[model samples]
Target: MLILGAGQVRQALDGAESEVVEAVRQAYRLHERGLTELPHSVFLRFPDSARNRIIGLPAYLGDDTPVAGIKWISSFPGNVAAGLERASAALILNSMRTGQPEALLEASVISARRTAASAALAAATLAPAGPQTGVSLIGCGVINFEVLVFLSALLPELDTVTVFDLDRSRAESFAARCTARLPGLKVTVADRVEDALAAHRLIALATTASTPHLAVESCRPGTLLLHLSLRDLTPETILAGVNIVDDADHVCREATSLHLTEQQVGNRDFITASLGEILADDGYRRDETALTIFSPFGLGILDLAVADLVRRTADHLGLGTRIPDFLPG
Candidate 1:
């Protein structure tokens, strides 16, 4: 078995958001064509703690090059206060020839990059107004940081960013980092979430909120909301937009904003199209009139595709530790 640590993973994917976005785009196209098998993610939560849980996502992606894997990840929101990462993950890819474990990798970076790439792809493919100069980030976390990076990679017109976080200090730190990463980029730390929401035509919500507590009525028409957190927007807010999801069946569960809206309306009529359908059918050339919301379910296939790329890159770069006898010989 080959073992890749976080540093190795990062080294393999450095400055590769464009490639990662294309990988995510291809994964969505393949998924739309039914070239993947993705079962429901397994959530293991404790009875005492509602904010923390571990998830197991098993997926098989088939094309000319086929691969299978499972990502084991844990989300503990309380870790941030202690100066620790909120999420940690690992992925194990199985050999297609012998069905044996071939590689093990630290997957939090893969997860974040793939997720951001997916969001970037959606933003590029769905935004009818094209890339905006200014954007708003609702949460100042690692996920949003990566999202901003990928968005900038895909849409270079984005030069201004407004950010809001309950922890003002963290928002300030996030701003500094953003400016440092993309020189000449202007970043604002907003004191109120509403101000951040109204700051730009492009908005990304990436928080750990377990419930819906947001209203989007104040935003302008044709606003692009990348609801990455999945639970920040209210059902009514969701209904106000032309909702596009990665997969209706996968997203319309887990009590997400879409799920809550479905329960409230007793149907999925608000959903306009899957990101896959939009990608496969080329989702552009439409008049910009109504609100647009892209709510991805964070599909397992995305993780698999990105992780496989990392694995291949690491292999080519001579990274990772090879355990010749990790399995029974």
Candidate 2:
């Protein structure tokens, strides 16, 4: 098996945001083609710790790219206290024909970038046609940071950003980082969630909160809420919006945003359409007056898309560790 480390993954992803977005868009299109088999992610939760226990995502992408991979990831929010990353992940790609492991890769970077790419794609597709002038980011962690970068790339009208985090120091640190990366974009630290939401018509939620469901009353009308954290918006908030999901079944089952709504409403009928359906031109329509919410359950097709790119790039650069022949003779 071939093993690609984090450095290799980062190198492969450098300046590859647009390609990643296109890959994710194609994956969503294939999803609408009914050619992929992606089960709802399996979650292991530890209530005692304010972090996800672990998550296992398995998927098979059909079409021109016939591949299957599984990502095993863990989240430990306390890792930041130790000066370590909050999440760690690894992915295993298997040969479709022989069912043998082909490669093992460090997936943390891929996971973050693919996710950010998806959000950026959705924003480009769903947000208003005008420039994305103002954006409010709810979390200042790794995911939101990447989201900001990709969103800026997609929506060049984005010249100002409002950031908020529970920790004051973290918010300040993130603001400084954004200033460095985006020289002209103004970055402001908001004192509260409402302040953050009200500051920008474009809002991205990437918090670690498992049960944070913000009310629509706190947001401006026509605001595009990018619920990247999965379960950050309440049913009332979601129901009030022109809701779009990556996959209706997957998001309703595992999306932290939709999970709470399903429990409260006892059904998943509130979802208007999947982003794939819209991208596929499958009779999906959007309402201008309604609040727009896009919840993605982090599909495996995305993982495979990014992983395929990484694998190909790593092969060209000779960056990954290769094992002796693992296939039986």
Candidate 3:
């Protein structure tokens, strides 16, 4: 068995945004082609704290580079109060031939990057024209920060970013990090969520909001909203926008915004199309004037695909510790 810590995984995936994005894109295509096995994510919640939960995402990608794995990640919103990140994760890859555990790796970076890459791929496929003026990041967290990085890679023309957070200091910190990472890019901190939401045609929400809060009254055409945090938007807000999800069955569960919307309308008609289906169809484009929101439930196949990439890279670079006799021979 090979053991890769966070630093190793980070080293493996860092500065490889293009590769990671492409890996996520291929994973989506494979998933859409029904070449993957992804069971519904298992959520473990506590009765004492409704805000904290850990999820188990198991998946198998049977593509040219086949892989099977599960990502165990926890999200505790209160962690940020203690100056700690809200999410921490680990992934385990199992050998398909022998059913033996091949590697154990820290996966928080993998998770964040894959998610951002997925969001970016959605942006590329759905909003190919790219953002003209700038983009707004509603939640100034790790996910949004990574999204900004991937967006910058995909859309080099993007020159500005508007950020908003309930905590003004956090938003300021996020702005500093944004400008430092991508020099020459103008970053602004917004006073209100609505201010950030409507500040640009492209918007990304990656908050830890447990319930629905804000929604734009209207939006201009070609608006691309990356709804990374599943529960931030109200059902009414979702109904008003064109919905594109990573997967319907997985997304319409765990009380996500789409699930809530489904419950309210008693149907899944609010969704325009899956990101994969749209990517599969080259000539399918939606009305440019519609408020198109991509709500990715954070599919596990993406984790598997990215984990495979990290594992292979780290192995080639001699970045992980290996134990040959861990399993019965």
Candidate 4:
């Protein structure tokens, strides 16, 4: 068995944004081609605390090298107040040949990076016309920080970023980090969500909002909303936008914004196209005058893809801890 820590995973992926983006793109294409098996994510919630829960995403991706894995992740919104991370995760990978677990990896980094890469990939494809004037980040957290890192790599022409959060201090800190980490990019803190939403044409919603807080009227025309935090927007807001998703079936579950939209609209016709479809076929239509929303349900296959990449990198560099004869005969 191979055991990888967060630091090792980070080292393997350092300065590898382009490769990671391509990896996520390939994962999407494989999934679209029916080469992936993904079951609905399992959510385990607490009866007393609505703000904390855990999720399990199990999936299999078939290619020249097939792989199966499950990501066990926990999210506790109150962690921020306690000076801890909001999310933590681990990935367990099983060998296809023996059906035995071969590796265990720290997955929070993988989770955030893959998410950012997907958003970056979609940003490049959906808004290929020109560089975005700026981007509005709705949440000031680790996820948004990593998103900014990848966005800078993907869209360096972006010179400004507007940020907002319920906690003003967090927003300020996030702004400072962005400015320091990404030279030549200006980061500003917004006092209100509406102000942040109006500040840029490209917006990323990464908050832990359990219910809908945003309305369709708040967004501007020709906006690209990266709804990363699934359940933050109202059904009306979702119905009014030109929806794009990683997988329609995956996003339309677990009470996400798209799921609520489907429930309200009684059909999936509102969804414009899957990201894979847009990537595979250039003829996919995108209305520049409408609000384009990309809601990714955070596919398990993504975690697997990055995990495999990290494993190979670790092997080449002699990084992860190895345990020979991990399985008994």
Collision count for each candidate, in order: 0, 3, 2, 0
lDDT of each: 0.90, 0.86, 0.90, 0.91
User: Mind giving the per-residue lDDT tens digits that candidate 2 earns over 37-126?
Assistant: 998788898777755578999999998759998999998888887889989999999999888999999999999999999999888888
List, residue by residue over 1-329, the lDDT tens digit for candidate 1: 99999999999999888779888988999999999999999999999999999999999999999999999999999999999999999999999999999999999999999989988888888766565788899889999999999989988788899999999999999999999998868999998888887888889999999999887876777888999989988898888788899999899998899999999999999998998898877635433777789999899999999998998898789999999999897
How close to the true structure is residue 54 of candidate 3, measured as C-alpha lDDT? 98
TM per candidate comes to 0.98, 0.94, 0.97, 0.97
The better candidate by TM-score, 1 or 3, is: 1
- What are the RMSDs of all candidates, in order? 1.1, 1.9, 1.3, 1.2
Lowest-lDDT window of 10 residues in candidate 1?
280-289
Q: Tens digit of lDDT per residue, candidate 3, span 1-329? A: 99999999989998999999999999999999999999999999999999999999999999676899899999998999999999999999999998889999999999999999998888778764544558899888899999999999988888989999999999999999999999879999988777777788888889898888776764456688898999988999899888999999999998898999999999999988999999889987766777888999999999999999998899789898989998887
lDDT per residue for candidate 4 within 280-306, as digits (tens), equals 998765677898999999999999999
Return the TM-score for candidate 2, rounded to 2 decimals: 0.94
